[model samples]
Target chain A: MLPPALSDKQTVPFDDRGLAYGDGLFETVLLRAGAPVLWRYHTDRLAKGCRRLNIPLPCQAALDATWQGDCTAELEVLKLILTRGSGGRGYAQPDEVTPRLLSRRTPFQPSIQRWQQGVTVRLCDLRLSRQPRLAGIKHLNRLENVLARQEWSDAAIAEGLLADSEGRVIEATSMNIFWLQAGQVFTPLVDQCGVAGTLRAGLIDQGVVAQRALLLDRLAEVERLWVANSVQGVWPVTTLLAADGSLLQRWAVSDSDPFQRLAHQLLGFA
Target chain B: MLPPALSDKQTVPFDDRGLAYGDGLFETVLLRAGAPVLWRYHTDRLAKGCRRLNIPLPCQAALDATWQGDCTAELEVLKLILTRGSGGRGYAQPDEVTPRLLSRRTPFQPSIQRWQQGVTVRLCDLRLSRQPRLAGIKHLNRLENVLARQEWSDAAIAEGLLADSEGRVIEATSMNIFWLQAGQVFTPLVDQCGVAGTLRAGLIDQGVVAQRALLLDRLAEVERLWVANSVQGVWPVTTLLAADGSLLQRWAVSDSDPFQRLAHQLLGFA
Candidate 1:
């Protein structure tokens, strides 16, 4: 679907930095009942990303206007992309910065089965590269995620887990992962890689999740695990598969009380 | 200037993977006298990039047709972007791959003064992240280069030298760098980071340049240094400045025989 601001155009400008060099940041907001869930968190992350990338933040009033004018879909996925705007050939930031704000809405396809019955996830062979500067911020340079997602084509596999080169588990391709062990919940620290997802942040802020460096080898010790993202609230992982598709670990979390409680709380927010 | 294939469009489709996740690769070809300089090298790199990224390579006949139909500009900078095509939301590769080939031509403006008198370069504070899988391919995930280029705004500084996080000198923002020491020419190994530039590859293939891991501390030992790219030819670095704009090293290469000979040889081919 066309972005609300760009509804009149069939495409972004050819010189858009977003297409040229991936010089942009994006936020995926879950829209329920025609209103964005955790919009403040999404905008906060986008603003923080802009501050780090040195791209000028779009005015809040402009964003509010766009939301009020275009947020009409009751059940949809909203994607807001802020690019450094069109510019000449070269890597240098343009002299007159005119940041382009694009908003797109798509029909939401809920992973209901995966969320209820639990889904299987496999470890991706592609290792996430360490870029502390770009880490945690949802910038547009997401080819690594694309590569990881391409590792498997099985419809049964709901997601693929990614790790850094050092064998430290990072996150799922498009979500934050959390493991429950000894009644403590742990999520991978995104300081060196992976996106600091909005739901993950909210959970952390609400004192339900704690960040820690997780090793791939330690997966067997986890009692229960689940993946979380804004669009897909939570999915308890029933199976963990190795890179070669060998079953590494399995958890009976489909009826676990803790898993259900956390998922319900998160889904309620969504 | 609009690409001949897309003169009527103001924007690329919003779903373009290149715009969405930088899921694409690009090649910048130097056009002189209505013909591409180093066309073989550029296409070779683009094809290699496609192979690595798993994006289906555009048919050679299609590429040839585009080149022939679009190479009408005598002096132009030709940019060819090949995206994984428009697709639905998500990181997964689309089921039906329809790669989008975009071509644009801009008037070539050679850095004549920098080429003749040499230019000053600075060590960028931003360190290039090592991602061996993505290294050396001219893919569209170029936020690192953009950040490095944004490190400096001085018009006098022609380029900024980038290094991996381990303090190993990689290359200039948009060009491959070479240093001459004891009559031996050395360029950074692109196995870990940096784009394996077309001109750099040509020189290496001709047994004129050798790849080596260069450290920032060893710059003082070099007799002469220059950066090379397809469009810019070569520019001897007359000064090396630190990230804070402090002069670290200076050289007189405008009259150096070796520098002039190499630059002339490279420029002649361009």
Candidate 2:
């Protein structure tokens, strides 16, 4: 089903609660092979987020009208943004409100080489604060991501992983993190913090990776690591380094590993 | 001096960093008579935030444009939104870009009774995380405030105060706070977290309040308490209660107190 369609033509008032307070949720979908990749999952997640944020779900008819149809080209991305309609200047939201939905298309092509060659990452000095209420959903409060992305200048560092206040590894700046431990794949739990990435959910659904509470002291034991997101797929980590320029860990994806095969199969890589 | 005039037909790209990643800074100015209140301080804070976030600072002409219009309707509110502008789909911003500046107008009327009569407050269950980098600036990453405001449905609670992970009172959801103790006023230090409110600075500048690290344990000793922001001015807190209905403290501003006079004089309250 297509998500609700919205544009400047829609009567979204300037006083939108979303614009005033960022009280909204959004999802980015991979438009591959002329359709939104895993659209059902994306919409389901958006629905769940709306439920959590107390936003009424939009009708399927309204949602279907959002598709641009020009997205038949491969390597395209679609984003759906939803927010509670305008309220007065105050924080108190109105009871009866129409949700604003906006959609847009973008051209994107994931680099298969980056996944196979393995990317380098650095540790961000900034730490994520624990917030159980707003955690796990792809809500718009992302100052932390913006700050972490600004931590490094070298184009070589592909991503920056963040830690919570207690020094526990949470996730990468824009993606979820997974590492090999005791011959099993483990990713951080998103209960108290962090977004539940769609790709991470796919991996966990396939029983390829398990969730665990990671400790800062366990970094030394992480053998091979990878970060996953819907857009980037899964990328291998070549070298992990601290902000002080000390090497932490490095890894290469085994060609015969299940994760590598799954990734290659999903992305159509030989 | 009036700020420069803004482009009336300017449109923000859907992929703008401000929309996608909340990478932006903002200032809410309270207009008195025909001009903005505390314009210099707001601009200074915005400039500081831009420097910290590595966003481009607007030129004098562009800055002046934010307030170069008629604003005489008894009371008015102006929001200056400065964004890093639009870019391709990635966290890494493009080089050689001009930040987008949008200034919008709102209606506001000062309620001195809310300030003088003292407002009721509730302790929010949501805690502000300590992020020293983005702590003081009124940047767009405000999921905490949105959630804190959602914690209460009572209009009687003018503001909800938040605490840090360690259970120390930080500030109200959108304002800075001060508590009177032993004929001295103390406000929490925002070096590690919380916004450095313009009104808070004015109070400190006028020698009516002192800045210090405040703890939750010290609330019981406060003889009077108040919250201040650019828009709300100074509001006395007559009763403070936690989320679980526990009494934290009681405060009031005596009609004859010198501090009350100072607040009225500083805020231009009648």
Please give the CA lDDT of all the candidate structures.
Answer: 0.82, 0.76
lDDT over C-alpha atoms for residue A211 of model 1: 88
**Off by more than 4 A, model 1:** A1-7, A69-73, B1-10, B69-73, B254-256, B266-270
- Give the C-alpha interface root-mean-square deviation per candidate: 1.3, 2.8
- For residues B108-129, write the lDDT of model 1, one tens digit per residue: 7776787778999999998998
Please provide, for model 2 over A1-270, each residue's C-alpha lDDT reduced to its tens digit, 9 standing for 90 to 100: 233336655323445555545667888878776576666667777778887777788877676556646665677777777877666435666766667788777778787778768888888898887878778898877778877887787878889988888888989998899888878898999877788887777777878889998886687578878887888788888888997768987776577556756754554443
lDDT of 1 by residue, A183-270 (tens): 8888999998899998888888888888899898998678888988988888889999998999999988555456446555764632
Each candidate structure's TM-score, on Cα atoms with residue i matched to residue i, is 0.94, 0.92
Collision count for each candidate, in order? 2, 10
* TM-score of predicted structure 1: 0.94
Interface RMSD of 1: 1.3
Q: Give residue A73's lDDT in candidate 2 (0 to 100).
A: 63
lDDT string for model 2 (B80-102, tens) is 77777677336677765567777
Q: What is each model's TM-score for chain A?
A: 0.93, 0.91
DockQ (C-alpha based) per candidate is 0.76, 0.44
Error of 2 at B165 (Å): 1.9
DockQ of candidate model 2: 0.44
